[model samples]
Target: MTAASRQMKLGAFLWATGHHIAAWRHPKAYVTAGIDIDHYIQLARTAEAAKFDMVFCEDAAGLREANVAIASQTSRSIGFEPISLLSALAVQTSRIGLVSTASTSYNEPYGLARTFLSLDHLSGGRAGWNLVTSASPIEAANFGSTGLRPHADRYERAREFAEVVTGLWRGNPDGAPGHDGQSFSVRDPLDLPRSPQGAPVLVQAGASDVGRDLAARTADVVFTAAQTFEEAKAFYDDLKGRLAAYGREPDDIKIMPGVAPVVAETAAQAQEKYEELQELIPDDVGVALLSSYLSIADLWRYPIDGPLPELPPSEGMQSRQALVIEQSRRDNLSIRQLARHFAGARGHWRIVGTAAEIADELQARFEGGAADGFNVMPSFFPGELDAFATLVVPELQRRGLFRKDYEGRTLRDHLGLKRPM
Candidate 1:
């Protein structure tokens, strides 16, 4: 496909609080992201009009960790439950795919498989599952544990967790197969008929070794925390290469890295807005959250206006560390600056500039083959998302880097991924 016809896939990476930490503080962000059905409908309507691919929602089973103080005063928590919300969204959006988060750690495979199948059927094949292993410390406590399984153990269970799920999704000429496995097993056929897209497209969000294994073995789409062109490119190449070891074709899976875009009429204006957003970041919560994300001690100990200390080596979380270090470097960010910056997009690429400039960067990533598209976390919400779907999307379409119309309805169709049998 040529650049215009190539149709880079796009999806919303929604959090109830909106992507920006202070988003709910914006004058226009709907107060009800916690449960506003109409607000979500508006997003879907706007995205579909842009001919974008899908809308996604992430989930957390635990009370949000950042809700401790001022951030709690914000919309840090809100949204109808994922499956229910998406089910509601499905009726409102005819073309945009619906992808909802479900935890492999918390849910049984047969039930999740059945739920997505039902969502697919309900939405006319527009459903997808964003599988998460539920790694956050807050998430562990929700499940009755004071701490989470070690990273290695989580992915280990995830491997078999996925194997059984995928096995159950297999439609023998007879029906859904029962492949008994170590971590999980199933014996009965799913009574629900195969969805129109077969099964809902499977997606995985972890980028650790175990995360990589599950995605390579079972998911049709994989998401990562890559925030720079280099980091994204490396991840793309690694994943494409690993597909062969999984005995899967490189093209069989689609890669989407998260990007946080802050658009303006000029580079300076975008930067100014970026700065203002950071300044608005509430201090105590932002500081505590920053420390929490990095597993560090009181980061505020460093001078607020001075340089960041060097990041230490880390495993099972290289991508996250790289994002933090490089962003602080690129922006020459101070402790205060870094704190607010994270509020905007949580360390994703913060593309700021005119429409053409934003388009240029997005197009470069697409051309470089680092991403099939993106999980766009708009710097703010409603307005920011509206700006993206309205202004930036049209510019991309005019340049032929994005689709003018969706040719397929399901998330699988949007990603050029095949439905599982």
Candidate 2:
């Protein structure tokens, strides 16, 4: 697509309170957001009104932090289950897509396929699934597993899991002899009709090599994290390049890296707003958050003022760990400094500026071939989401980088994705 014709796709990444680690502590933040259905309903309506492509939700099967003290200080431990939350939001909003993360690690193909397909019909085809392999041990323990599976083994299961789900979604009716794989055995087709937009959009956020390959094979949308233009571009090109091997074109998939933006009427105000949130993060909470992503439990053992220690590869979030390590070394940041930095945005690219400045950065990335779009991560809910909608979105619309109004009813049309046969 030509530059003028290609508009950036945006997903409102909805988290309770906000995406920042210290969001729930912000005075303006609604601390009770986790239990407030009206809060999410209002946020969804706001995104729909702003013509966002979708509102994405993340999920985990268990507690986010293992340490009770650390977990108590933050709001990550409390939130609505994403699928249930989105199902509720489906009836409340009419336009924006509702996408939720579900794990292949803990769910079977037949059940997962049926659930998302039902959601697609309920939302009039505005449903998506963000595929993830449950990487955290805390989640693993919940399912009575002996331990977390190795990274490669998890992805292998995911590969088979995705194939079965997609086949079921396509209405495969051969049930006499059904799929019998290493991890799953299925004997019947899904007891559901074909999806309204052919099938609910398939989304993935695996950035490791194996993860990227899985995404290229089946994902319609890929969410990623990158802190620099070079990193984002490299990932965008690599993933898009792998598509041809699967008999798919580059345009077949959308690559939208997560972007955490703190926007205000002025640059100084935006910075001030970000600093205010930053100051709310406690030292232990910051370190604990970093440790969880790094897949290590005793990060607190390291000297806070010292540089990051050499570490083994992470089986949890390999891509995220690598990103954190790169940043720490490149900037020569100490443990405390790195923790504070990543704790704010959770390892995604962060931009703090006025509406025009935020728009300028997004435009450069979109037009510079670094991204097909962005999954916008607001620092706090309601207020920050409102700021992006009222301030930055109009600036993007004026430059023709984003849609000013809904031109299509389903998420497929909004994303310009082809309706699968």
Candidate 3:
């Protein structure tokens, strides 16, 4: 296909019950979806049936909630380890890609390499790694660290960590000796056949400057959160611009922004569905969730009708902090409004509309230089996911904006990504 004729690549961003913070409480949602392997299997099968390029599972090193109080009100703390979950899904599905998020901060490069390589082999070249530097203080405490390593320091380690992991994945062609790096030293040969599509597709989700640079140098698929067309375009331009400096082409990296869609037969129905989930967010839960993402002082002290409080400096999630701040200011949203917004998609974009409307947004973003595609995050599991497949996929296919059927067996082929040499 010609460049203009290239179909958009889609992936399912599989969260516990759904992407919406309150999805677990929705009447139709599977509240126990996190622990239900059958739920994930069905979702995976649905995505594959919809010809989705991949199914992505994000992971956290510790309980993602702010405290036991907030944790009690939500199901964020429950889930399967991504690799184990994806490995199980591998045998049950044949076409959709399986991507799992794991922290480079807590993992050994050799072990991660072996795990993903084995996964790629097992799945017959349908594996990917979503590299992350553990960002939560709770995650730090679990690892016996007093606090998170400074952002810059963590990225430094991650840069070296990624280098070591990729080098290990590359293996020694001569099979003559071991490899050594500042972050990792491995003396054993991989002793495995090259996967059908080479190494697992390297995916990254960081948006900070250091993170972007690391992705430019290494990631084949870059997952991001862009709340608007302009910002998404800016990010697309900046990251693509960095490729030449790394001796890589712009096409080397595919940018897929996360979008949570609340789809229904009409705009009214869509909003009804969206509002139902929003209403499920208890005030305390909303405040706590937004506060965690802002990584500043607690938000409960701020007046609901007043402007957002001036945030304290956070060594936590810097990119998300800036996005939330800009959004609040630009939209003139009060603390209450901001809290609800964050609860919707954290920092990712949300589209509440008919299936055609959702497809229109994706098409505009893709052709408008804002994204190569989207990582579809449904507002509620099974139900919303089913809606998108039954309604939206056909709309895109009819418009020739997406695929109607699988054109290739491996995720790399589906995404038009080349095998790593």
Candidate 4:
């Protein structure tokens, strides 16, 4: 597509309550959002009505926080399993794509491949999978593993897992000799037919060096986090640059960084709205969140007002750990300050502005080659999503930066992705 015709893709990243740690406390936020299928149905319909490319759900096998007290303080402890949730939504919403996170760490390839293909057919090709190597020790413990696998080992397993899943989705015949690998073994092809869209769109969010390589090899869409234009651009260029080696073109993969926008009619209102939520965050909750991202324990033991202590490499999310440390050092922020800042959007880029201002920043990133699109993360559910759909989406449409209407039925058609041969 030509530059002028290259409209940006948007995913409505639907998290429980909201992306903000303190979102459940917001008077307008839906406190029961995690269990309310009706709430998710409403959220999905809202995104579809706004012409978003998809409604994305993130999943974890276990509770997010190990500390029972900390876990109880947040709404994250309760939520529908993403696959079942998306399946119910498949029948509820007609056009928007339904994408959900699933981990290679805990699931087998054939079952996962079969499950997503079922969702694809159920949605009439409007399905996608965001692949992740489960990074949390809490998740590991739930699966009865001795401990968390090293990061490299997890990715190695993921690489093979993805290969098998894609192979099955691409029509590996039922009686064929199947995969025999280091981490898994498969005896037969999936019982289902090929996905209605050729295959369910493969999405990945790992941004480490190995992660980038994995994405280049397999992902049709990449969801990432970047706090700056420079960071986004560099990641975009590097990942796109790797396509050649994989015998794929740059256009084959869509790189969408996560963007959290707190938008209102006026800048002051937006800022006020943001600060209101930030003020609701208990310091301990924020610190626990920061500690999880850092892959460290007892971050609370440090002086909340003091500088971050030096750290070793993380066996968790390496890219996110680096991002946190970089921000802590770059801004000379104390633990309390950094935790509060990151707690709002969990380290994704945040924009507190009027509709037009938010559009300008998103336009800059898209037009400047820093991103192909964005995964829109609203601070709170319903209210914040409603605000963006009403205020920002129209502004984007008016500027011709986003689609005014759906051009086709399937997610692949909306994304202009090539069908598998």
Which candidate achieves the best lDDT against the true structure? Answer: 4
lDDT of each: 0.76, 0.94, 0.88, 0.94
Return the candidate ranking by TM-score, descending: 4, 2, 3, 1
- lDDT tens digits, residue span 11-124, model 1: 887677577777766666676778677877887787788777788888878665644564466665545788988898888888888898888888888898888888888899
lDDT of 1 at 224: 79
Question: Which 10 successive residues of model 4 have the least lDDT summed?
Answer: 170-179
Q: Residue 33 deviation, candidate 4, in Å?
A: 0.7
What C-alpha lDDT, on a 0 to 100 scale, does residue 240 get in candidate 1? 82
lDDT of 3 by residue, 326-402 (tens): 99999999888888888988889999999989999999999999899899998888898999999999999999889
Stretches > 4 Å off in candidate 3: none
Clashing pairs in model 2, backbone N/Cα/C closer than 3 A: none
**RMSD for each model, in Å, please?**
2.5, 1.0, 1.2, 0.9
In candidate 4, what are the lDDT values of residues 67-155, reduced to their tens digit? 99999999999899999999999999999999999999999998999999999999999999999999898888889897888889999
Scored by lDDT, model 3 comes in at 0.88
Ten-residue segment with the worst summed lDDT in candidate 1? Answer: 313-322
Candidate 3 — which pairs collide? Answer: none
lDDT (Cα, 0-100) at 411 in candidate 3: 81
Could you tally the backbone clashes for each prediction?
3, 0, 0, 0
Q: Model 4's lDDT to the true fold?
A: 0.94
Assess the local accuracy of residue 355 in candidate 2 as a C-alpha lDDT between 0 and 100.
99
